[model samples]
Target chain A: MPRLRIQIRDLSKTFREGGREVPAVSRVSLDILDKEFVALVGPSGCGKSTILNMIGGLIAPSAGQMLIDGAPVRDVPRQVGYVFQKDTVFPWRTVTRNIALGLEYRGVTGPEQGRRVGEAIRLAGLAGFEEAFPATLSGGMRQRVALMRTLIVEPEILLMDEPFGALDTHTKLNLHAELLALWEAKHQTVVFVTHDLSEAITLADRIVVLTRRPGRVKMIHEVKLPRPRDVIKLRESDEYAQQYSQIWHVLGEEFAGHAV
Target chain B: MSEKLKINFWRLAILVVGVGAWEWLTGIKAVSKIPGLYFIDPFFISRPSKIVERFFYLNSDEVRLTLWQMLLSTVESTIIGFLVGVSTGFAAGLVLGRNDRLARIFEPYIIAFNSLPRIALVPLVTMIFGFGLLAKVVLAWLIVFFIVFFNTFQGARGVDPDLIHSARFLGATEGQIMRTVIIPSALAWTFASLTPSISFALIGVVIGEFIGGESGGGIGYLIIASLGTLNSADMMVALIVLAITGIVMALGIKQVEMRLLRWRPEYQQR
Candidate 1:
């Protein structure tokens, strides 16, 4: 078995708005093994992103402990990377410069920086647009830049919060294919959060379903989909349909009483 | 005709008609004889031709050197004041924007100071700094600082929290985040404030000179001197030069803005 990459023990988060204490995530605990792809799915306002943020060390947990490689996470670990849902690519920086940002911050200069940034540009299929700014690029292209920026740093654990949630179905499928190809080569540990159940089934090794607001683990279903899988073709398979139905049965219950 | 050509034609037409009417009205002796119509007195609102003639006379060799000296003084004070104001305002804005405690402590005082009609302080500033370039510079600085400071402060404060989080995740130190993220984000606002700041700086300097009288040897002083001697034509000539200077300065700033902010969508080349 692969070594455990992340350990979450009774992790919880409560947010304060005005004078009231609103619970976002409650007593959520799960372990992620190295190179495992886990997807957290639930209705909107289910604290899916709050969980990802806590894992990435972007926010302090209100209670409970989160451990990465047996060490408590106090700040963003060097081996961890996070891809936000919003288009966080700096509009001021060009494709090359945006990809080079992390390396530049780490004081990696000279040809080494150029080589890495060039490789990232090629990886993201942003070759001819190397000098192009974010404003000039399409929404899908900009998100690719945002992804490549995080990927270039080569983090061991990649926490993504609905990274492709904003794209259209066509672009979304294309990105899913690209993402799977990249993951197949690197096999990095990934914890993805999404509202789309099909996306969870298509991408994850395991799917963790959570209840509506004040989110808790409702069920955890392991995906037995084989490796080197085709994101588009797999949706047509019976096994994929069965897994989707099973997860949806649990995920649908949470959204039954309200608009999703 | 093209839209731009049509617009320019109308603008020129308006200018001709306006100036032609002004010249005709001032030349009418009967209109001046009527007490109620004396508002357009030739001695006060001088005709366009006399104003143009006075402009040429000021630029003539006999008086050109003095005019040049006065123009240079005003330009120097305006430029110096603008630079000082922008730098100090930008620094203050960044610091206050980044520090909540500092902003909270100083916000009330800043708002109070900004609320005061800055023009009302011109005489007081001139009195303290005396009738010199220093007085004009100080007044210009006072007017420019708040314009730059407020815009920059808003810009710095309005940076997306996601960007800051992304920078931190990428292993950026606080100082690096400030330099790479916060400063660049605030720069758009800072640049937005610059055009107004420069105009206000010139206004402040001229107002300072107005209060300082002829002792402050600048374009403002020349205008005051013309006013004292009742040479309406010379005063109008000085006013035209100032207007031209303001336009030139605004154009220069536009060029710099376009160059610096080419990354912006509006400035991007197709």
Candidate 2:
């Protein structure tokens, strides 16, 4: 196995709301290898987003440790990038300016900053809407801007929390294809949090199934599918069906426990 | 008709109808002497036509300085007060807002100062600053400062945590985040407080003039002089000018707001 790019050791998070302790995650240990796309799949309220937030150093893990590239993740490190479910693009900034924010904040100026922003915008298929504000853009287009905003910084690890959960199926599919194409080219380590099994199967190299609520890792499934596979075509295959049924079975057990 | 025209038409109608009714009831002596009818005497309320005529007359020369000169003096003080008040308040708010410990330490003092009857301090300010244009400007600044300070404090404190987190993850330092994220986010709130604060500045200047410089300085001075001799028409003329000034200032603020906040999406109700 490749040297682990990200290592989470018995990670957990608990929130205090209204003077009560609400446990969110429970002793979730995992290893994500370099250049691997790992999909974190679970039922709603399974702390999927919480894990991603912890990994991104947006929130501190209550009772565990996180190591990225053999170093402890103490704060929001420059090597880590996060894409939120909601559009985090500044409404006041135009597409080009918004995408350039990371580089700008890092003190990259002049022609080099412009070149990087331009390249990311082009990759995200947002070339013509460079000057458009977030308000003027469609939901899909705005999310693209959000993605480009993070991608332009050239982070080694990208942590996404249900990045396309709000999009329609057609838009979601298009983004999935676009993301996969980009990921295939760059081969950065990605940890994607999602509830959709199909989305997990479509993008991830290995799927990590998490149990509900005080979430813990239930199982890990390797894709076994070849690289450069077409998303639409892969779903039609027998392997995809078998993999889907198996993951759904494990997820249903968590749902059954949750229902009680 | 278009929305703008329709709104303008209604506004004009309201002004005409309201003033016409006032003119008929109080301005015309014949209307007041109608059998079995008691009406407000024109001497008390004054006629719109007489007020307008008095306004023109005063503009030419009713005192040592023309109405225009007095108006210019009042505007100067108000503008100075507004600029000084807004800048200081915004700076203080941003500093206090970013530092929770500092905000807590000074909260009581700020509240105490804000709660004190500011108008009552006019006499004290007049005594210290000598009833001049400086006194009026100081009073205007004092009144406007608290209003803007409170709004800006809230605005800076209320910046969305998500945005801050996003900015931090994108490699912004504390100083960079303050400039690029916090300040811009606070701008909408700062602007929201502007209109009321500006009006307060005008009120402060007028009150200062009314209390001290009653001879030949401002519209408030003219009003006081008119009231001394019970010249209701002259008083009304001064009031009309004040009203026009207020409306014009409000419109100017709205234009500035629109220009600065062009990025905000306009939401329409269906």
Candidate 3:
């Protein structure tokens, strides 16, 4: 694949809690190829965000190496967009400036900056809201703004940490569809983290299920559903139930008390 | 232009009404004073005429180089002191806020120094700087330091962890993150703190003048001189002038804050 491939090997992270060692992410490895839309599905606090952070270079693995483009990941990738789990809008700037932020940091200025920001806003369905402040935007709109902000920089890879996790279920599903549409248009390698099985199943080209407490790659499901996927149509497919049930059965033990 | 003029007209009308009410009440002996309305008399304690006279004499070439010179002197001292104190405090606060270890080490020393009566050293400052510009400058700086330091420290530490993490995720270098997100975030807090910081500075400059005074002139010195000569009117006059100037300086900073911080939460309401 001409796209970026993230290879995680023996990665583990342990935090010192009350003079005792507690592991967040146990020895785990993952191989995501170029232009591959991969979903890391796990329950809340299952360290899905942690793994995304490790790949995004926001945190260091206590005991492992991550290879990107066949090279060791030491710092933030020069061409990767890391979307946060929450709205990342700077309150000081309007939606336009917020969207242009990554590009601005990448040294885009004047006409180029303005044009890129305009296109990003349009893509995010926020064209009429360029001058609107973040405080005024709805939760969904803000998340959309966050997405465009990262995507505008044209990174080869996109690492999103529960981008729409904070939104309502309806908003989350709608945004999932929106994101898939954008991804289909761009075909950028995306690693999305989420607790929602449907979101993972609907959006990912391949879904990697993670175990709870000292997170490890519990199982990997190849979402062989076809391109430009309609989430509704895909959900109704026989393969969807088969894969969802298989993964659910494996994760059902951990979902013990958190069945909801 | 018309809207603006209307607003100004309303402001001036309110000012006139206030003044007229005061003038009438005091003139008719509605208020009490030392030996009746004599002190309350606008013509005696801080007469408008006397302040106007002083205002016009701001640049006379006589022994007193006009009110302008004194004002300039006061302004120079105030600004220099404020900048020095603010910069130094910001630097120290940055160090302390980020490095809790360093803060723990020097915190006791800072508290001890800050708690001391800063005005008590006015006489000592006068002795060292010799009634010259340096003396006033030192006094001004002394007054400005603690406020700026404490506020900047709080501001620096109060930077949003979310913002910092966002910056790092966006591939912001440590320097860029500090310069763009953290500094601006802290600046909002710092400017808000500056409201009181500047008030303290006013006290600093005025106290310096009262304790000893600059080479020859200052509003503070004028107040003292008038008091020494039993000229309550002149003292009142100087007091009014100082009050007006102080209020104006504070308002000026506030206006700048408004323009600079249009994004602040306080303004987010309307």
Candidate 4:
């Protein structure tokens, strides 16, 4: 068995707004093994992002404990990288500069930094647009820049919060293929948060479905899909449909009684 | 004709008609002598031809050097005040913007100072600095500092928190984030304030010179001297020169702004 990379026990977070306590996530416990791709899916306002934020050490949990590699996470871990839902690519910087940001921040310079940035740009399929600004690029291209920026750092744990949630079906499929290819090479532990049930099934080794607001783990289903999967063709398979409906059955229940 | 040429033609036509009407009413004695036309006196509103004649007289070899000297003094003070104000304001904005405690402590004082009509302090500035180039520079600096400071502070404060979070996750220290993320984000707001602040700096320096009167040598001093002698044409000439200077400076700054903000969509369209 793979070693457990992340251990969460009785983790909970409650936010206070307007002098009233607003619970976002209740007591939740789970363990993620090394090299596992775990997807967290739930209805909107279900604290799915809050969980991811806590795991990435972006925000402090109001209660409970989290351990990464047997050590408590008191601050943003050095081995973790995060891709936000919004396009966080700096508009003022070019594609090359944006991808080179992390390396520059770490004081990496000279030919080594150039080689790494060039490789990342090529990997993201952004050749011939190295000097282009973010404002000129399409939404999908900008998101790819954001992804390549995080991926170039080569973090041990990649925390993506609905990274492709904003793209259309065609762009989303293309990104899924690129992401899977990159992951197959690195095999880093990925904790993805999305509301799309089919996306969770396509990418994750395990899918954890959560309840509505003040979210708690409702169900955790292990995906038995084969390796070297084609994101588009795999969706048409019998097992894909079986897993989709089973997770959707649990996920759909949380969406009921809420306005569409 | 193209749209641009058509607009330029209309602009020229309007200027010609306006100046011709002014000259017809005041420059020609016959038109002034007409019934009810005497109210348009050259004494109050100088004729365009007389002002142009005064402009040429000032530009002549005898007085041209003095006129250029005064113009240079005012321009120098305006440029110095702008640079000093922008640099200091940008530094203060970044410092206070990153530190909430510092911002909270200084917020009330900043608002109180900004609320006052800064022009009213021109006389006080003259009294303290003694009606020299120093006083003019100080006045201009005071006017520009607050404009740039407020915009930059708002820009820094309004940076997307997600960007900061992403930077932190990428192993950026606080200093690196400020240098790479906060400064670049605030730059858009800082650049937005530049045109207005530079204009205000010119206004501040002129106001200082106006209060200084004979003690200072600038276009504002020339205007005051013309007013003292009751030479309406000379006053109008100075006013016209000031207007032209302001327009040219604004256009120059706009060009620089476009070049710097080429990354912006608005600039990219052009």
Candidate 5:
């Protein structure tokens, strides 16, 4: 078994606005092993993104602790990378320059940065548009650039907060495949956040569903689908249907809570 | 291509017709025999041909210094003022933008200074700086500083917070974020603010020269001298030159902006 890469213990976050406290996450704890692909799925406003933000060190936990590789996160750690839900690629930088941002920040040598940027650009299907600005590229292409930028830094843990949430269906499907291939190859501890349950099932090895607001772990489903599973084709398989319903059964109660 | 050519042709035609009508109306020798048929006095209105003729004569002669010298003086003041104003304003905006407390502390004073009629301060500035290069430069700087400062401040504040967060996770230090992200973002706003500052810088120089104290000769001074001597053609000639100078200066700034901001998608079209 791989060693634990991320450990969250008694984690809770309460936001104070105008002196009124609003809790976002309460005592939500999870242990993600090295090379594990975990998908956090919940209804909207469920603090899934808030959890990811804490892991990435973009925000602090109001209580408890978030540890990466056994060390508590005090600030943004260099070993962690994040892909935001929104287009976070700097529009002023060219595609190649955008991908090389992290490497440049780390003070990697010029030639090394260029080589890594070239490889990541090829991996992300951004080979030809190296000099194009983000504004000129399509939404999908910019997101690919964003992914390449995060990956080029080679962080040990990747925390993606609904990175493909804004893409069209066709683009989303293509990106899902691309992301899976990249994750499988790198085997980095990946924690992806999504509101779509089927998406969580299609991509993750273990799906952790959370309840609606003040999100807490509701259930965890271990997907038994074989390796190199085709997302769309796997949907028709008996095991896929069984696991989907099994997870949906647990999620149904969470959705009901959302109405009240 | 034909549509573009037609537009250009119409623009030229309008200019020609307008100038021709003005010349006809103000024709001194041509209307002298018509006996009270004059709608305009040539001595006051000044025909375009007479102005051009006056331009050539002044170009060769020195009436309160040569036309070239006066233009050079005005250009020098505008350039000095622009450089000082833009650099100081951009630097101050960058510093205060990151420090919210300092920005808040200074906000009221900035607003008060910006609201004052800048032209009304010419007498005070001339008294302090003594109607020299410094006076004109100070006046031009005052005209440009507030416009660029406000835009730079807004631009720095408006930088996408998500991008900053991403950069921080990417291991960018505070200085790195400021250099690669905040500064470039503010540069766009600074450039937008610069377009108007170019005209205002020139206005400041002209206004300073028109006030006329010690460091006495510029295009503005020539216009003032011409008006004083009732030489309407000289005044018109100087005004035309000033207009041309303003256009040329604006075009020069545009060229620099285009070259520097080629990374921009919208500007890439040109």
Candidate 6:
């Protein structure tokens, strides 16, 4: 097992809306290992993005502890990269410039920055799109640019918040394969938040299911599928069926919730 | 033969036909003096060729103070006003935009202040700053600032929450996000602000000329003196000058906007 150890204790977030405090994420706890592609599966508005934000150190946790690489984080640490659900490429720059922005921000010096940017563009399967503007690129390609923008910084962990929820299934599958291949090579600690169970199952080494509003972890299921399992073959595998049954059983109950 | 040339020829033809009708109507005594035409007067509301004669004399130092000097005065005031207004507006807007709480408290007050006709301030600025180039520049600045400030403020604040969330997730510091995300978003709007702002800035200098005078041969001064003496031909010449100046400034700003916003959605759509 890779030593990409992660620990979170009593994580919570609350926001004031319409003069009332609304809980977003409630006292959630999880410890994920190094190079563990953890899929946070939940219904929409279940605070999966909130959890990802906390991990990325974009938003401070209202209460609780989170440790990545055995260190407590107060803010965005250099060791983390984030891919947003929507395209956030700078509209003033070409796609190539957008991808190279992180290197520029981190003060990565010349020649090397260009080379790494070129490599990342290729890695994200954004070849021949280096000069195109974000507006000119298709939705899938723009998201690819967004992913490569994060990849250029070469962070140890990646926090992806439903990065493909906007793309159609066909585009999503292509990107999924690209992402899997990229991860196989880099082996960074990845925490992906998604409502789509198929996406979660296809990508995750371990899937952590969360309950509805004010989300709390309900179950964590591990995958025993072989390395680099073809995503298309997932539905056919009995192991896939077993995993789906396991996740679905946990989800259907929590989805019904401990309701009145 | 080409589409562009065909459009251009039609526009030119429209101008010629309109002027011809104006000349015939005024010659026939069918129009009023308030709106002069080509045949209105020999010395006062003279024909287009006569106004063009005055415009040609714009090249002479004695008759028109030379074309270069008129251009220099207008260019200097325009540049100073634009720089002061745009920079101040951008800085204020960017800073205030981040503090939504503070912005909300002050927004109504800012809007009210902008609503008060700014032309009223020309006299106030001339009194406070004195009737010099500073007064003109200040007048121009006042005219240009509010439009730019409001547009920039909205642009910066209206950044999609998702983008900021993404930036924060990607290890961007607040300062980095402002420089990278907030400013770029605001710039597209700021460039738009320049069109109206340039027009306002020109009017400011003209207003300053009305109050203090660009001393001599200024377009505003020429228009006023021509009106006072009822030299309608010279007034037409000054009006033409003013229109040309406005077009040049507007076109210049549009060029800059095009250069800056080459990646905007409109650019791709076009």
Give me the TM-scores of chain B across the candidates: 0.91, 0.89, 0.80, 0.93, 0.94, 0.87
What TM-score, to 2 decimal places, does chain A of model 3 have? Answer: 0.93
On residues A1-260, what C-alpha lDDT tens digit does candidate 5 reach at each position?
78988999999999998999999998998999999999999888889999999998878999999998889998888788899999998878999999999888889968888899999999998889998988889999999999989988888899999999988988988898898899888988899999887788888999989888898988888988887867678778888889889989899888877875
What's the DockQ for every one of the candidates? 0.80, 0.75, 0.47, 0.84, 0.79, 0.59
Error of 5 at B220 (Å): 1.2
Of the true interface contacts, the fraction found in model 1 is 0.75
lDDT of 4 by residue, B36-113 (tens): 455467988898878878887887787744666778888888889888999888888878887899999999999999
> Per-residue lDDT of A84-155 in model 1, one digit per residue for the tens?
999999988898989999999999999999999998889889999999989999989998999989988888
**What is the alpha-carbon lDDT for the whole of candidate 6?**
0.82
Model 1 chain B worst lDDT run, 10 consecutive residues: B31-40
What's model 6's TM-score?
A: 0.90
For candidate 6, write residues B206-243 as lDDT tens digits: 88877776452357777777778787777788788789
The segments of candidate 5 whose C-alpha lies over 4 angstroms from its true place after superposition are: B28-37, B62-64, B213-216
Those runs of model 4 whose alpha carbons end farther than 4 Å from true positions after fitting are A257-260, B30-39
Q: Which stretches of candidate 3 lie over 4 Å from their true place?
A: A1-4, A232-246, A257-260, B1-69, B99-106, B214-216
Task: For candidate 3, write residues A212-239 as lDDT tens digits.
Answer: 8778888898887777888767788898
Candidate lDDT (C-alpha), each: 0.90, 0.87, 0.79, 0.90, 0.88, 0.82
Alpha-carbon TM-score of each model against the true structure: 0.96, 0.92, 0.84, 0.96, 0.96, 0.90
lDDT score at residue B44, model 1, on the 0-100 scale: 83
Q: Tell me which residue pairs clash in candidate 2.
A: none
Q: What is the TM-score of chain A alone in each candidate?
A: 0.97, 0.96, 0.93, 0.98, 0.96, 0.93
Residue B167 lDDT, candidate 2, scale 0-100: 87
The DockQ-derived docking category for candidate 6 is medium
Q: Which residue runs does candidate 2 get wrong by more than 4 Å?
A: A17-20, B1-14, B17-27, B30-40, B214-216, B267-270
| Alpha-carbon deviation at A237 in model 5, angstroms | 2.3
TM-score of chain B of 5: 0.94
DockQ of candidate 1 against the true complex: 0.80
